[model samples]
Target: WSLGLKGERRDLAPVSTSYYRVQAPVSTYHHRVQAPVSTYHYRVQAPVSTSYYRVQAPVSTYHYRVQAPVSTYHYRVQAPVSTYHYRVQAPVSTYHYRVQAPVSTYHYRVQAPVSTYHNRVQAPLSTYHYRVQAPLSTYHYRVQAPLSTYHYRVQAPVSTYHYRVQAPVSTYHYRVQGPVSTYHYRVQGPVSTYHYRVQGPVSTYHYRVQGPVSTYHRVQAPVSTYHRVQGPVSTYHRVQGPVSTYHRVQGPVSTYHRVQGPVSTYHRVQGPVSTYHRVQGPVSTYHRVQGPVSTYHRVQGPVSTYHRVQGPVSTYHRVQGPVSTYHRVQVPVSTYHRVQGPVSTYHRVQALVSTYHRVQAPVSTYHRVQAPVSTYHRVQAPVSTYHRVQAPVSTYHRVQAPVSTYHRVQAPVSTYHRVKLRVDK
Candidate 1:
């Protein structure tokens, strides 16, 4: 029936097909549509099918897969994966992977973490360990880590410190005042200069002995030696001895007597007696025994007993018996004496007369007279008796009066007439 059927086939039924037999049948499909789709699609579908298929995903995933592909695949499929099973199954893969660590911002902190210790910072690639000592000291430590041994140089802490030490310099000084006698010292350091001043060697006063003194008199006397201390301090001394003395006289007539002293004695005696006369200047007079009146006697008459005597004169008379006389006479100009024979009643008489003298015999009995005359008279008469006869005459112009007569008469009686006359011329 090839007639026109109305088509309403809405059923879930099988439909039959018509085939045409062609003259030539192609053995392989040869066209762009027949190649099993491209290798890109297969590669994209590779992850969905196999139990161990790996996807060629991004390079990161690829790298992961290549490292642990089985484990990652099993894990993503949510299978019962054990850590030991994956670990046993995984290959000992060697990978040259470089892991970049965090970038190091090298920094340091400057701090005195403790008041007693010092802080220091070192160079790069250096490390250090610090220890704080209780007594404010610092200790350094080197870090020997597993990787490397780091070298560390530590500096002392910055802080204030104190210590007990000697002063910087040494010095010395000296001083002096007024009068200094001696100063002795030992110097320790270098000397600069020396100065000195002298005050006084003031004079000292003392005493000494000089010379011995002496004193003397006008006489030749020994001087006494004594010391006289004059000026300042002195003394005196006296000699121990006796001194001699002398005398001084006035004229030639000198009378000397012995004088006694403390040490010496003296004596006095009479010297020879001397005499002088008016005529002779000095005469040696002989000693005689004469009366003081006999030295001056004069004769007056010319008779045998009339005489004058000058210095000292004396006479002796010897006569015969009865009517005799004796006379001794010395005169200035002349003198006379009579010597008569033994009388048969006659007499012998010696007469001395000076100057003018006269004598006469009695005119009756036998008698005689001897006489002389001169200008001046000197006579000596004896104590005898004479006869009264005639008185004699005057014989001189200027005459001295005769001596007054005092008689001692002894005569025999032969009387005669006698005339006594007195004459003046």
Candidate 2:
């Protein structure tokens, strides 16, 4: 426990050394382990029923042997999960587990060093979707079981959807490395398999990828998309940089900057209006994007049909489990109206929009104005509908400016009409 840890904590002590149990409180960072029963055999039981806001650890190392039975209800993680190192030896039984955000900087390794048996993680939404079989390398997973029917059923907090996976065993995925830029990465290796789904435009600069691969597949959209692959591809979206070379793979290689393994899945991705990107697998709904949805790489798997997104879509990294709209996070987009007034023939409107909204100009030489706006020269905020700069960047003659309007004015940004005049150089 650290010096300053907040939240409520409870301890339940039992007089048994055969098995230990722990119940953790939400919004907490510290957890005390129940005393070990024996060095030979270990067993754990936990009951979880709550909303986990941010349950993460910088380095979570578990070196033990256990047969764990978990009871869960309404289990939802509505944020980013960055598990730097999670090492466990147990059977995780679960139901309706969902993570709704981008997972970055992940390294998952599971091994049975001394004939240690059965280390598994199961979920209803993650839903035991992957039977990862690899040995010896960085992400080396092997599952040896007779008739292991991996029934892939992806369920969000909403409805029920499904898929299936079948593969032969014994291949260790070694040395998987890359600079990963991702958003809305859903359903990776057992709810840990990540592929980005972005909405809107994407732009990438100085992007790179490096890896040695077995097989590769790539697809590109219009407007100058560049890809550099070292191997052959069957399913590839957007890839940059370079890896060494190898042979064949049966998996899907979508978007990534750097990867060095037999099967590589890490990528630097962006969304529509997204560059260095993958894409929002536009499903059965009608999202009226007034422009082309820009993405470097994207493969729309079997997502939902009733998923609806409206207005100027901002950066909404939505994660969904099958049949569970629990994570169908409908983020509300704010509305920014058009600026009404005249047009400013002012030269060099440096950065009219940035990550936020920046309208820069030489306020000294430029004359500013408001509404009674001009007849032409309407400026839409470069980012989203929410970025309505009330500042006097430009406008027509003097009149009341709309509360949510942007007017590019050239003059002494002497602000009238209670509007702010931002003169950024």
Model-by-model lDDT, in order?
0.17, 0.21
- Model 1, TM vs. native: 0.12
Q: How high is each candidate's TM-score?
A: 0.12, 0.18
Residue 268 lDDT, candidate 1, scale 0-100? 12
lDDT of 2 at 412: 24
Clashes of 1: 16
RMSD of each: 92.3, 22.7
User: Which portions of model 2 miss their true places by more than 4 Å?
Assistant: 1-21, 29-119, 123-206, 212-287, 293-425
lDDT of 2 by residue, 1-425 (tens): 12113642331222121111222321212123223222111111121112222222111222122122111111111112111101222222222112111111111221111111111222222222122211111111221111111222112211121111111212222222332221112222322232122211121222222221221211121111112212211222233323211111112222221111112222232211111212222111111122212212221111111111111112211111111011111111111222223222211121122222222211111222343322322223332212223433332222354323334534222222222556343
Off by over 4 Å in 1: 1-308, 318-392, 395-406, 410-422
lDDT of 2 at 3: 16
Model 1 Cα lDDT, one tens digit per residue, 1-425? 11113763222222122112222321222122211211111111112211211211111111111111111111111111111101011111111111111111110111111011101211111111111111111111111111011111211111111111111111111110111111111111111111011011111111110111111111111111111111111111111111111111111111111111111111110111111111101111111111111111122222122222121211222221111222222211122212121111111222221121123421111112222211221223322333332443333322232223233333322333233755322
